[model samples]
Target: MSADVAIIGAGYTGLSTARYLAASGVEPVVIEASRIGWGASGRNGGVVSGKFRIGFAEMARRWDLETARRMHDLGIEAIDHVGETIEELGIKGADYRPTGSLRCAHNQVALDALRAEADWLTGTLGDQAISMLGPEEMKAETGSRDFPGGMLNRHGGVIHPLNYVLGMARALAGQGIRIYCETPVTRLGRTADGIELHTDRGVVRARQVVIATNGYSDLTPATDAVRRRLIPFRSAMIATELLDRPMLEHDRSYTETRRMMRWFRKAGGRLVYGGRGAFGKADSAAAFAALEKAMRRQFPQLAGVAVTHRWSGLVGMTMDSLPHLSRLDDRVTFSLGYNGTGVALASMIGRHAARMVLGQKTDAGLLTSEALRPVPFYEIREPAVRLVAGYYQFLDAIGR
Candidate 1:
């Protein structure tokens, strides 16, 4: 084999896996369809969240409470792992901040639910810094009175996502990990000895192959089992061309929620806000208008903030909301489907993939504890998701 392992996609998962492989004395080759950070890793909301309890109950039921908690802790550990890497690698371009995150409740019902969630998180997750804020407190904290109350998680934060991915690529490439940009893997099949990665540029025969293509799952040949287990969804974001002094002084960008969830941060004189992208191509005037309207509702001071850029990326959603990390064959393995929290979870998953490839096994409850059950009647998932997502946008316009 030319290389011990070949990882497709130079996004967060692929870059992290390459780094891990290098550290473990295995040099892997990475292929990117476009430039580095071209996928969802470069685009999505740049928030590090510990609230990925999506299907928390189901995961607990299947893996036991202890394993579930450990898995949850691994998500938190992923953030720390990224932070440690940033510091160790001396990556300074990515404007990393630990200012924490605020989850706003726009209505009484949402506020009540947030309060309960805060209490539950505090008690069960050993998280205490989560504090509930009233309307006045929310106003004071965010310089907006749009939300009645919210919960602040001090452990969470945000970063310049594109820069972070690029830094990771540089770090891994410096370690002699072969990273090929503008190279797309067309197919992956069984070879005589191991796995073969067929690409547009060349074929890479490796002893092991890691499918780090999270959002671009369709790029790979999905067997019938996988075809039924995962689906791709798109997310969109827009940024204003830096707010004026009044808005800047009055507000510090914070993640907030009403009918639809939004993640935002004030950087480079612009307010970057992101949420579920509308159906179809990313460039939607309606989506940009929706974002602008939401921003105005939150901060009325900046009603005419000009939008500078708008973009979108696909995210892989698994049937159970948890990812599946299993060996498809003898020498091939994959870990994907972040469900929308890949920014914080991909690093840890990549680390685990490294361990899996090295045959150094641990608890392994992070990815495989839950069963890979497809969503019942998932054939209608795409169109149904589009309809529901559009409805949310319409409903959010009315602040419902």
Candidate 2:
């Protein structure tokens, strides 16, 4: 069908952009290679927050101070956006709870870093919602005596990510947005009128095109800028069998450590943990075993917990850990590279991309800045990433 805008990839970014575009009287068509949210957007720990390792200060330096704050706030606001949409549309299955998020440090040094980060968010960044937790408090809240200290952000929350995406797609489809599943666009040809997207079923033409395929981005023709700037990394996650009643009562999402950070939470009454998988073997048996062993070591009470589900997905990792929203060409725009933090950022970036495409001005920041240039030597990024992943896997094996 003909449209004003055609979006490839019906994951969070594509869905959000389609909704906004449709609301603005633009009946955008979203084409998904598989089912909606079939990628990382569907499979995630569902932590919706802006507490990224890429702190606000660095963001301000890269983009602008005001823009950085606004971008950070946007990430925080995406959680509310999801909740509001669920309520407005009366979606039943997408469970959203504002339970907040905690970041614990396994060691004393890392605990100090957590305290410092919390302090920076409060003192410098003016985000007072962050509170430092002592060792005793961490033990009480997380039911993990191994944690030395931590920080909690009340603005953060969790949800069933897949259910949310599916609900979003349904909401958009009801609003005249044409969503075609299992229709991957193999060719994107620019014409005088607009862009042509060639899919397996047929071809579509549109004035504007958006590439929302974050990690799985190679399917369509990408501008050199995008190809050079973004690197895809695979993250693995495993969910344990429904924990016994005692463990269930103390379940909450959390993360720890310096390099290989662990992000996990209780979903469907089972403990789900995520982290860097074994590079090329991301989510392979070795990776799953490592995740389970690490989890068991963290909470020996859960040593009896057997893994029931294991999966992995590629994430677009930008050097700055921020995503890009810009015009690669005259009509082609994109918002990619969530840096393993897509739950909230994808929705927020999708909104930014929509605004940019719709010709609305946005606060320029690291998350939405022209200064987000391509990384140096980016052509070799994929190979370098693979090498790094292999090295990390080897080190992880030796307990380094």
TM-score of each: 0.90, 0.92
| lDDT of every model, 2 decimals | 0.74, 0.77
Residue pairs in collision within model 2: none
- Candidate of highest TM-score: 2
Give lDDT: candidate 1, residue 124.
74
Candidate 1 residue-wise lDDT, 1-400, digit = tens: 3699988788888888888888888978888888998988887667776556363444567767786577767767877776887887677687767667788886777788778777766777676767887888777777777788888777757778888898888877776778999877777777678777777677888899887777676654633345556777777788888677544333333665654577677766777778767665345778778877777776776666677888888988886667767666668677787888887778656777888887777454657655566666776777877887779868866766
Error of 1 at 41 (Å): 1.2
- Tell me model 2's lDDT, rounded to 2 decimals: 0.77
Q: Which residue pairs in candidate 1 have backbone atoms (N, alpha carbon, C) closer than 3 angstroms, thus clashing?
A: 242-269
Off by over 4 Å in 2: 60-64, 220-225, 248-251, 375-379, 386-400
What range of 10 consecutive residues in model 2 has the weakest lDDT sum? 244-253
